[model samples]
Target: MTRTHVSLQQNFAGIVLTQGDPGYDDAREIFNAMIDRRPAVIAQCRTVEDVKAALAYGQREGLDIAVRSGGHSVAGASVIDGGLVVDLRLMNEVSVDTDARTATVAGGATWADVDRACQPHGLATVGGRVSSTGVAGLTLGGGSGWFERKFGLASDALISVDLVTADGREVTASAEENPDLFWALHGGGGNFGVATRFVFALQPLPVTAFALLLWLPETARTLLRTYRDMVDRGLPLDLGGGMAYLTGPPLPFVPDELQGRRLIGMIATYAGSEAEMRSAIAPLLALNPVASMIAELPYTEIQSALDDPPGFRNYWSAQHLAALSDEAIDVFIAQGEAMLVPSPSQHLILPWGGAVADHAENWPQPHRSAAWVVHPFGLWEDPADDDYVISWARNAVAGLQPYSTGAVYLNFIGNEGEDRIVSGFGRDNYDRLTRVKAEYDPANVFRLNHNIKPWTP
Candidate 1:
């Protein structure tokens, strides 16, 4: 290594890794196995100051910069080839104030970290479904979770975000400070800057009930229709979950005949007791699911119950719908049949309403007004199946376009295109976000995420 490289490392409080360094390759690895980027340097940032130093160094060196948090960007935006990555994983810390009912989470923290910390206090804000998802990436990009319909999307709970801007400035965006930027941060992805910390408004969630019921794929039609009917009839705000088509596992609840089979599953969570959940799930129970499990558990336990193991090649996409017509249900089920079995893929139809629709106008996320979200989470181990799996997700989204709202959740997709990105925020919000981008990042230094180009006067 050059003397300059050694000197640069000595000037920082965090660790710096160059190519061939002991943890370099592992540090560059993200959630998707399909991404194989090799950054020239990775600054393992520990503090806001460390983040600032890394940003300044990357800009001064004219290196492409990617900020790494939970490293869960499906597009692999957290890492760049032959560039610099400000790795924030080491900065993970969660501090909860029980009195104020709020949580201040470090940039690199995962949903698991926040949930665990807040669970003890009988408090939690909405977070990503997967426990390992980065708090900053999810919240800044518009987080949707199991309880989103009850409280709101993850971004909706955000009180403020501390960020390191393109110009190496430490700034905090909140309702009372830089309000325009704060609005843009909602459903804005990571376009504006590198978020270092986030403050979230917590809710009283001392108890929650969880359930998982499985049936043969043939029951998908009945299940989807029942779920649609329930939503139409005004399901309780406390209930939130999705119907998924996944590879069934060999759990005790599963019949020996159904284990390792492609099955239709309903995972429901209620913001109440198991008895309350039982009453809420009666209609579904009447459908006679082949296997089931239900219990009142800690919110943290439910957060990680469905965690997909790492090291799987992943491809995912979503379509927001204006309504779930009968035709749409059939099409959704048909696509589920195309899903790769003996794998960890999830063909999901998630209800979107209640708080999601009520608070849609308060943020930049355009898809919030939609009645439903169709997500195809594709995860498999074989590289040979990449094209097929990606195509399956793409086709699933395509089939639902007739009923689409034309807006999508950015977090649920990869690098689709500029058009999809614009659709995510809609034209008006996109214009506003661009103006904010122009003010904070005129040069577009943070363009690795779903980019919003600076507005030119």
Candidate 2:
């Protein structure tokens, strides 16, 4: 295990970047502006053998290791300070088997990449609304998206993943093989190892219709009420819906009349025939859109529509609630209308009862009790106004606590440490996950992400 004795250059067939290396800055950058950490080296790995070698080097030298796939981790967990980063962004390869309804994607692939390859054949796996998000991190965090109500979370559709463990071993975890590791990898953060590849079960890809977008400031109460009723009645398996408070941007998509304003947006998508898609959304279309951008676009374009935003500094803290109560609605609207920022920063609440709420066991994921996720998110440009955005979000969450289940999504969190991450899992689930962490990584080497610390020896 001598550091220099082993021929690392020969062992690793991928590129490595030390300090001052051309790719070091790009490798360290994450989506969250609040985080800035520099790692000693960045292993921009290509092959699985590269991942194995990087892990082995980190282990032998007692160096901290950070596993980065998309580099979009909100908590800045994908990069570390003075550590070794195994950057998987370069491993973008995919193969499809249409007959078996499955796709094996390289770990670094994005939602856009998956859709481009799969949508032509009218096949798809669970992908997020944001197109640029990595398939590995998002799916592993229990993905939610347009098709989530009909299909399941991305993790549930997983067949297997090729991972590099803490002990420098490459292994595959699937339902029928390595069952416990497979169970933990789904919705569990990167605890056991760095996932190098994913085998996902494909579902039918339907590009049916785009419903009207209704804009209303006075109808927040009615919209949430009606939305809840629709969910309770059990929506058609072909239908998917989400409602949010959106701040109008400068895009031409928003009419000049409504630019730079806040409006409640109710949007839906359906996978049936064109007529059925129209009928499924007839209830909302009746409201008469103040300004609408609904059209018949392919599912891939629809999913990636919001992929690029005029980049701005953002701060976010999120909580998943048992229900979206009237009081919660009021708090959201009040905070939303109080927007003092320049860029698109607004609160988003996505419901979760359809396929996600039916979980039967106490896995590491504690989002089971939550029916909706309230994201107090905002963005601004002036460094001085950063305080305003964070404070505004903090106060809103403080008031809405009574309705919340005290659970938070790991991916949406800002760069806080171990205690905050443990809180996100709640007391019981956090303890359970901690035990699992102890069983997998007792030395606490994998402590960068929304961490669950292994119990002290």
Candidate 3:
């Protein structure tokens, strides 16, 4: 190895992998198989000191640095070509304080880690729908999950965050300390610095009921209208989940005839007993689903139940809507019909007006106020169908432009462009975030994410 590489390994209290290193290939593999970056160095950080050492080394060596936690960035921002990756996978740790109703999670910890750690105490905060998603990445992008309707986004529950700044400074952002940075982190993504730790306020969630109901694709139009009407009439905060059109998986619960067929499905999670969950979704249940699975599962079980398998070529985009009118429902159903069947793709319509809207003004994500989000999640195995899947997802969003709020949730999308990034946070909030970015990361060292550029005259 080169003297510089040896020097970095000596200074870092963690594993360092070069191109030919034993674990280099596995270490560089991210969730999305489409990304094939070959970083010059991968520093698998084990402590805060390691993160600092790696960041300093990258900056001094004039190599681009990408901060990686769970490595779930759809755009593959966590890895870069011929750059340095400060990978935090080894730092996955979780400590729950039962008395304080809080969880202090290491930066690399996934939703599964958090959920499993908090499950025994019957406590949880909003997390990403996929259990494998990075806690820091999702929370920074305004966390969306099953419990979001009840407890708000995961950022709303954050008590503090420990970060390593672009200049190799150790700092903590909280309400009483570095409050501006804390506010910017709410939905600004990883533009400012590398988050090392997060303190999240937890809530009591002793019981969680989950129900997945499915129907033939032909019933989607009627089902979409009914779902929209139910949301319009006001559903309880305890109820959380979305309706989607997906290819039925080859699970035992699904009949053989429907295993690969596109079908309409509703997934509901209630922070209560099964009976209560059934009552909460009675309106739709009355419509007579062809297949159903309902149970009082542990919160952890519910969190990981629908974990999306990794190594799939993924392309996703979303549009937030102020309202879901009948015409919009028609448009959504049409998009669903056009989805690539027999694939893991989902044309989702999720409600967003519960706790999400109530705290809209508190953070940078003004799109939280939108009543609905139409997310076209495209996951396929073959690289040959890349263009078709990407076009379908893009077209799905374009079809609903007339009904959209001109805002978006950044986490639901890949790297569209700077305009879409600005739209994630409103123009005003984007301006504020740029100032924060300037203060902490003036060099724009951490520019791999949906970046907020450092401000300039």
- lDDT of candidate model 3 versus the reference: 0.91
Shift in Å, residue 435, candidate 3: 0.8
Candidates ranked, most accurate by TM-score first? 3, 1, 2
Worst 10 residues of 3 by lDDT: 1-10
Cα lDDT of candidate 1 equals 0.91
Backbone clash pairs for candidate 1 read none
Instruction: Show where candidate 3 strays beyond 4 Å.
Output: none
Model 1 lDDT-worst window of ten: 1-10
Poorest 10 consecutive residues by lDDT, candidate 2: 1-10
How many pairs of residues in model 2 come into backbone collision?
Answer: 0
RMSD of each: 1.0, 2.8, 0.8
Deviation in angstroms for 241 in model 1? 0.7
Error (Å) of candidate 2 at residue 32 is 2.4
lDDT of 2 by residue, 358-402 (tens): 552535567655877777767776778878888887776776788
- For residues 335-361, what per-residue lDDT tens digits would candidate 1 score against the true structure? 999999989899999899988888889
Q: Which stretches in model 2 have alpha-carbon errors above 4 Å?
A: 1-8, 211-216, 360-362, 415-420, 423-428
